[model samples]
Target: MSVETVGIIGIAALFALMAFRTPVAFAMLLVGFFGTWILGGFRSSGAVLITETYGAVSNYSLVVVPMFILLGNIASAAGFSRSLYDAAYAWVGGFRGGLASASVIGCAAFSAVSGSSVATAVTIGKVALPEMKRLGYSASLSTGSIAAGGTLGFLIPPSTGFALYAVLTEESIGRLFMAGILPGILMMGLFMAAISIVTWLDPKAGPHGDHVRFLQKLKLLGKAAPLLAVMVLSIGGIYVGAFTPVEASGIGAALVILIALAMRALTLSAFYEALLDTVKTTAMLFTIVIGANVLNPFLAMTHIPETLGTALTTLGLGPYGSLAVIILAYVALGMFLDGLSMLVVTIPIVFPIIKAAGFDPIWFGVVAVIVIEMGMITPPVGLNVFVVKGVAEDVPMSAIFRGVMPFLMAMIIGLLLIIAFPQIALLIPNSMFG
Candidate 1:
């Protein structure tokens, strides 16, 4: 077989392995290693694999991953999730679909501190789902809001996805983090608007509740102050150039540890568990990244991505039309794979096409993250829905999926807005760093 044909077969086999339930890292590693061996002799391929693995994992920028994950773990262990939900519920719970809106607000705040979508979904779901059920909110709206909102984990500052994208693409991590801010806020706004419209049109979906006194609401705010402070210190520091992305991650991790200690939420056992979870999650992410390093070079050698890029450019689709196709592809893939897996699997091919079409890499990163966020709320393999279902076991998985439909619509609209006006994602980064 020609080298290019071999690359194509290897790619197909990798997807087959993933579809058969092989772990993503293993799938990539298996295909990458064998593809390398096929393209070059065993000796050269083995040497290249070893060097690439070490080089990918040993980079200084990669350290940010564990630090950010550790920070998120500490924040989750610190009881910040409850505080955020309580504060949001106190202020927003009186209106129609108020609890659902509150869930989105809480998820956004939690995303600032916890950068993993699953962590955001599980943590906030534990706090918000029962309350939503108690208030008679529709299963779909409550579950969907949390599922969709959890995606903010990657769109807000301290985002793990952004950090990974920055390292992979050699973009500035600080600039990428800055770029996400406005788009994240816009997403939150769109979600809130969606909830309001849904409840207004069908009040049965979310019944209104008695208002909390202003004093009670203010007291709830006090509980959330520590987390709010952490968000400002970490994100604000990065925005103002007080610290680089790595430095901010370290500082944020330290600050979260301190907050957890002060809140008396971090017992020795909890702290140990947080550390172990961070280690496990970080290990998984790094493993896939190293595998991608090997696989991407092999794909580059085949010129598959370049050839695909040329074909798309020649299809007479303008840049916008081409971007629409990429976003649609993400939506379809989202149903079948986890967000990170989708990112690792496709970015090697799709990113070059995006850049070739003259889109900014940082801007495209934000767009990609938003698209993946929609996937988190999508059906079949929606990670956020599963997380919420795990927490609210009484709510059927089917109901949870149904509940997220409007939020999914909201996400689609937000994605469209970002794509239509690149400045939605670029304004903050350009203002702060340009």
Candidate 2:
């Protein structure tokens, strides 16, 4: 059979396996292994899978993933997220829909450390939902804000999304992290605006929270200062050339642990749990990486990426038009696939077309992540919405989905802004790394 035909069959088999609820990693591994064996020999496919697994696991740069994840897990166990919510609440909680806005800010602050959207939603939801409920906020608005804010975990600096994209595309982790900074802030602002509009349309949806004295606000801010400091040091250190992304992760992890210990919030048992969770999460990430690596070679043998890129170029669609199609595909796939799986599965095929079109990979990484974040809130398979629902059990799942709609629109607008002005993503990375 022709190589293209083999590639098409392989892709079909892949989707079929996924349809049956096969783990994405194992599905890719099985398809990639057998496909490579068919195109090459068993010997070459065996070598490829073994080598890819080893390479993915032993890569030095990847240490950043677990280290950053550990920092987030430790921070969560130690109550740092609550302090962040408190600080945001002290400042913004008194306005109409202020509690929900504070939840967005709090989510952003925690995401700066957590780097996982699900974790961000769950952590902030546990803290923010009750307060919003007490303040008479609507379930839709309250749950909606937390779910939407959680997406920041994937867009903000130290994002796992950026880190994994860097691994797949050979982009600089530091530059990708920098690229996300401005866009993350812009997204957060847009979410806040969504809350403002939601509350304005129905004041009953979000009532005023408690007013705090200036001294009280400062005190709450002081309580959360350690988290802010850790964020600045880890992410800022990269921009200023003080540390590599990996080093920054290590430092951030150590700093958060020490802060937790100093506050008497981290027990020996909690530390152990943090380590365990980090290992589990890290192992999951590595499995996906290795699967992608194995599958990438099989794909190369089939020449699918090259053929697809050539086909797209022949279509005479300009760069922006081509980009629109890709983004639309992601939105469709996101209805069923998790962000990480969607990313790993598609990058092998998509990255080549993007590069051929002369688009910047780093900027594309930011754009890709924002779209993935949108998927996390999109319905039928809205991962973040499900996560928030789990935490706010009293709030119906439908309400959470309804609440996330405005934020989803805001995300689309932010994405368009970034598309029209790539510099929003490129400015910091170009200035710092040049």
Candidates' RMSD to native: 1.3, 0.8
Query: On a 0 to 100 scale, what is the lDDT of residue 255 in model 1?
Result: 87
lDDT agreement with native, every candidate: 0.87, 0.93
Number of the top lDDT candidate: 2
List ranges where model 2 is wrong by over 4 Å. Answer: none
Give lDDT tens digits, candidate 2, residues 1-434: 99889999998998899999998898899989999999999999999999999988888888899999999999999999999999999999999999999999999999999999999999999999998898889999999999999999999988999888988988899999999999999999999999999999999999999999999999999999999999999999999999999999999999999999988999899899989999999989999999989899988889999998888778898888889889999999999999999999999999999998899999999999999999999978999999998998888888899999999999999999999999999999999989
Error of 1 at 320 (Å): 1.7
Regions of model 1 farther than 4 Å from truth: none
State model 1's lDDT: 0.87
Clashing pairs in 1: 140-403, 144-404
Residue 292 CA displacement from its true place in model 2, Å: 0.5
Residues 227-315 of candidate 1 have per-residue lDDT tens digits of 79988998899888898878888898998898788768888988999999999999999998888887877788778888888888899
| Best candidate according to TM-score | 2
C-alpha RMSD of candidate 2: 0.8
